[model samples]
Target: MKTAEGLKDIIKPENLVYRKSSLITDKPFSYCPGCGHGTTHRIIAEVIEEENLAENTIGVCPVGCSVLMYDFLDLDIQQAAHGRAPAVATAIKRLMPEKFVFTYQGDGDLAAIGTSETIHACNRGENILIVFINNGIYGMTGGQMAPTTLEGMKSSTSPYGRDVKMMGNPLKMTELVAMLPGTCYVTRQSVHTPAAVRKAKKAIKKAVGYQKKGMGTCFIEIVSNCPSGWKMTPVESNKWMEENMFAYYKPGDLKVPAESDADAENKNEQ
Candidate 1:
């Protein structure tokens, strides 16, 4: 009789000769089955391989569900204190201007505790990329209410449903970040479907490209699903994100800075 691993290999062809996955271990991930983190990990790995940036890129990981991302992403990684990834990335990018730097942060870490750090990073126009995952609830902490928790959503901390009067409205970080002068590009995308995933990959690649060109602060916000925290199956969570979450946080490019006024004037004179 064949082993389960053998059966899996037989069922799925491994003919595609892409770069080997950067994940180092065979241990199963600790994430709940079907969690969006796995998908995000694959996308990031593919992007790193396709862009040939594994050697020069560094990632600052936040203290949320993705805290253990260093174990998976083979590139150089630094773990940051809760909500401090942006600040850490800023320092690294400034010190090593030639290296590509990015921070992977969840909504709870970025929109809640790290709001000031994230905002200031964008305002300062740091030449770095930020991948923000907004899954609505605080997935790492037993489904607590987060700053991005939608109205009428029920979580362990908000069992009675989010009360706008008491809890305040959902914080739209992407929209807010777009308003800052330092931001060169900002877009909100989702990863719940094949087409959406492709679009998200494009957005991420664009953000990385902007940083490589010395453009300040490229941000991509991805609307993901937390199946375990949402008390639903993975399919159900995807449905919820599409039906409810998208209505509130419609995905699109929120900002793109034009050429510097000085550069444009110089070109015109020549």
Candidate 2:
């Protein structure tokens, strides 16, 4: 009888102490088993919940695999045209200044077709956040070549490998965005490991916090894995990201509100 009681105690819901998952793991995610989008989505959802910004948060999802993010995130979400998420987010934040507005974009949407929109939005110092996923290829568009495709990486369009002389090097979106003075916060993070995941969550939280504080543009470029496009298993894709991608796109905060004397002086003058 004592053993039976103990077993019942172990299985009790109160004894289990179940905390609501910041992530909605029960919902069927559209992403493949090894896709990094699922991890990114979970982190974003957790950050929103942890910060208690669900009511005032608004998300703009681009026309890519990330477009389905609206369905997964239990927040007010708007769908943007291909590569126009930044523009959409800018308008939303401008009209509803009190609300927190963010745009989720993929490499193909942000780096290629939306290049002009992304640059102008950052240049204008829009009070919004951008979560950019750099997965090398256009996963939603049948794995076509993206501007961020590394030199010599093969894609549907680049069957013989990307030729640097013709294709140019992969676009480093984070570095480019960080160069703009209007961009207050910019970082490159990954979801390949637990440590990296923690760092990414921190970066995401900081980005949203900056927006909430009425700071200008905040951009987070996440180097994500796409097993289906990369032709590697989930484990192999994680390994590949750590080895090759991390070196090229080293993860860290590339830009933030200036603390240096020169920056202070510039801000003072402005």
Candidate 3:
């Protein structure tokens, strides 16, 4: 067996593969054991730290599971009324154009009551990042059905499973926003697996870069798992999300800037 000092030599900076972002507070996450909120928070913090935007970034969050986001992120965080995050984010960005502004919202808050605000924000082409977490149900305020809830999915309000005819089809908010002219980038991603996390992180970084360039609104929808709300093990929720949620809300970019615009931006940067 190696002594403690001998082990330290093997665990030098050269062997360091990963480290927690300083932007993330040391407080333990309040999310459920299998919830995806923790992973999403970590990546967002990492992105801000990696870009050296900790002091210049401001995040807006509304009611729902992410209501306590201010406790985890070490930055200027604004709390908006339930389902009003987009409006608040727009105001903040307009007031402080030099600062990086983003809204972190859940599906129920973003797609239901705040639907008009979200649509108008994108339509107006606000230069902000919208980080949307879609877990189908209201995770924090009981497992209630949300606008993005998959058809036939069970929730506290829809005990017998969602009825499409009665409750209407699940809304594809991401797809809806992608069609708006104000949005420059729109993508749907997940963080259920290691590879998925990598892709999601890249997507976030790209959105931040676009926001920095004032390229309209950049929206990223993270299809997350709500184990406690879904009444399943974390592993089971991931599997169900893959089989059901992915089928309806397919992943990948829904919108991107035209080639000419992208080329022009790239050249300008150079």
Output candidate 1 Cα RMSD. 5.6
The C-alpha lDDT values of all candidates are: 0.87, 0.87, 0.93
- How high a TM-score does candidate 2 get? 0.89
lDDT of 3: 0.93
Error of 1 at 173 (Å): 0.5
- Candidate 1 or 2, higher lDDT? 1
What C-alpha RMSD separates each model from the true structure?
Answer: 5.6, 4.8, 2.2
Clash number for candidate 3: 0
- Model 1 error, position 63 (Å): 0.7
Across 1-270, the per-residue lDDT of candidate 1 in tens digits comes to 569888677665475554446543455567787777777777877787778888888899989999988877777999999999999999999999989899999999999999999999999999999999999999998999999999999999999999999999999999999999999999998888889887888777777677878979999999999998899999999998999999999999888657573354346436
Over 159-186, each residue of candidate 3 has an lDDT whose tens digit, in order, gives: 9999999999999999999999999999
In candidate 1, how many clashes are counted? 0
TM-score of each: 0.88, 0.89, 0.95
Stretches of model 2 off by over 4 angstroms after superposition? 1-26, 260-270
